[model samples]
Target: MTRYVALGSSMAAGPGIQPRVAGSPRPAGRSARNYAHLVAAALGLDLVDVTYSGATTAHVLTDTQRGAAPQVDALDGSESLVTVTIGGNDVGYVPMLFAAGLPRPVRRIPLLGSKIRSLVNPAERYVALEEVGAALVEVGRTLRQRAPRATVLFVDYLTLLPPAGPASPLSDHDATLGRHLALELERLTAQAAATTGCGLVRAGAASRDHHGWSPDPWTTRFGWPVPRRPAPLHPNAAGMRAVADLVVAAASG
Candidate 1:
């Protein structure tokens, strides 16, 4: 049997979606419907999905959490395909988004506002970008050494907001920060892919038209209620399918 592994953060884990991977002691929050499983089924391969919500590059390279092994350890140089969606958490992207969406009462507090501003600060954002960049480089180098024959592909994050600027519902400050981070994350991923010789899947570009601001959004928003589940700031079913198409193509071709 060919070893096909999936690694990364919540985006790769597919939180809030069901028939989750059962029997795991850890709260993996993995969805069987995630792009990894979808792509594995499309390619008829057994998927060893080790993706967990809130995982960082450090978690991928080393065992940052108990019970779960380092993501790279899942690769034993025998994988035929490996897909990773990471780096966003390394840069504090999700926390920034959630903080930006804080209620008015919380934002009214001086200390809270100041902390949020620090996260939105350009200098701070750039510092995180640099850190994630270095981590990506190490990630690329490690994967090449471990899974030399596997078709390693870095699946970038999906589009969360509009390209022009953030839409309504998001505060002016939050909107600005959201848009900036969205574009910067993609750029960082591309740079890593180029440096590592790993195949790049333009999941973000493919998701542009399907952004949460689009007429038909592929991702959920801050407080929107979807039937039975709420995967806010994460990709919806259609979005996952679209990303699966990109991955399948890359793995097959």
Candidate 2:
């Protein structure tokens, strides 16, 4: 039987209200059923989930917390698969962008434009991306060292905001910024995968068509109320299933 290990942030941790197992402790409202669990089950592999909430690549590679293990320690020579989703929290970039109201068109810029111009210098963004890429490469190399035969898959971040809505005033800018940030992250992840000789899974491309009102079976809109809970930008059970399907296909192939 193949063993699989998944590493990343909250999305990998499955932060949301799930149907609680009778004896299992209920995770917080912010915790949803993430894609890793879904994929592991689909592949019938022994799953080791080492994902943490609010984790960046640096944190995953270094942090030690109860229930949240370091990505490096999860590796074993006998493991057959390793999947990683990381780098969003680095520099607190995503939250800064979103909280700065980049998700909303009007507030995004010149506020976002000015902030982007002022706070994160071009040199800084480049340097940060470089660091993120290097960390991913290290993660890949470490996984390979520990599990020489395992097929490593490195996943990029998803686009949390949907394309501009017709009714929204900031559609064009929102779309542009969202795509810009997502693409940059994708490039960094791709670079890491290339450096490490690991497989790259582009979540943005896979999810491009299904955002906002057109959410795939796996996602819900930002403000929509879910049964027994509410989650903002995370994937729901259906989304996890979709992620699982993609991962299983990749692993099986």
- Candidate No. with top TM-score: 1
Candidate 1 wrongly placed segments (more than 4 Å): 108-117, 224-230
Tell me the TM-score of model 2: 0.77
Lowest summed-lDDT stretch of 10 residues in model 1? Answer: 222-231
Q: lDDT scores for all predictions? A: 0.82, 0.64
lDDT (tens digit, per residue) of candidate 1 on 134-178? 898788778888999989999998888877765666778777777
lDDT of 2 at 236: 61
Evaluate residue 134 in candidate 2 and report its C-alpha lDDT on the 0 to 100 scale.
72
lDDT of 2 by residue, 1-253 (tens): 4888888876566566474323332342223246776777677878777676677776667776455456678776888888888776764445444443434343447666666544334455556666776777777777777778889898776555565543132245444554556677888788888888888877767876665446353444445345654255666666666677777788888
How far off is model 1, as Cα RMSD?
A: 2.2
lDDT (Cα) of model 2: 0.64
Candidate 2 residues lying further than 4 Å off, grouped into runs, are: 20-32, 65-67, 91-93, 102-127, 163-175, 213-217, 220-230
